[model samples]
Target: MKKKQQEMQQQQELQQQQQQQELQQQQQELRQRDLQQQEKQQRLFFSSSYFISFAAAVRWLPPLAFGEGKNLTAAAAAAAAAAAAAAVAAAAAAAAAAAAGVAACFFLRKEGEG
Candidate 1:
């Protein structure tokens, strides 16, 4: 009877150990998933921030340049005109860049889903 009891106790202990191991594995997997989610979020935030900064620079730089040129002599008129033209070009480029960034994000998302 004592031997039987010892054997049963050992079996119970083994089962408990296996359950603990399974729980640990599950916790590890959950942690890894969380980390991956955080990394993805960080990437998205940085990309958006970069896009915002680029857009703002494109929008404001031309006017700032033109304003500074006004402080100069008669050449300031020509410089201001050139700055305005450059601003238009910059706006077009910013639009193109935004489009490309959006396309890239979509492509990456598709790849991740696959």
Candidate 2:
């Protein structure tokens, strides 16, 4: 009776170990798949060719969100870059207007002065 009990306990331990290994294998597979997805996303976002092609085609892209995370694509990044460029242009225009105003004040004559 003692020997039988010992053998059964050993079998149970072995079965438990096997189950643990199976669970670990499943977890590893899930981790691998997650890594692959992350790699694919990085590749899609950072590919220069993708950006070049997308840039060539977005002349007609209507107004859009183009925010990060929610819209994390090369096209979205290009849109953001374009917006930044536009903002810089607007600032430069404002500065030029201010400079012209200053110049006019210095150069233009009063109503009675020639």
Candidate 2 lDDT at 5 equals 100
**Residue-pair clashes per candidate, as listed?**
0, 0
Measured against the true structure, the TM-scores of the candidates, in listed sequence, are: 0.52, 0.45
Please provide, for model 1 over 1-114, each residue's C-alpha lDDT reduced to its tens digit, 9 standing for 90 to 100.
999999999999999999989986886687577557655765665566556545544554665667765534544454555556556656665675677568657855775586
Error (Å) of candidate 1 at residue 93 is: 27
Off-target runs (Cα >4 Å) in candidate 1 are 60-114
Error of 1 at 55 (Å): 1.3
Q: What value of lDDT does candidate 2 attain over all alpha carbons? A: 0.61
Per-prediction RMSD in angstroms? 10.8, 28.1
Which window of ten consecutive residues has the lowest lDDT sum in model 1? 70-79
Highest TM-score model number: 1
User: Model 2, range 1-114, lDDT digits (tens) per residue?
Assistant: 999999999999999999989986886687577557655754554454445545644743543344344334655666677666655655655575577557545544442264
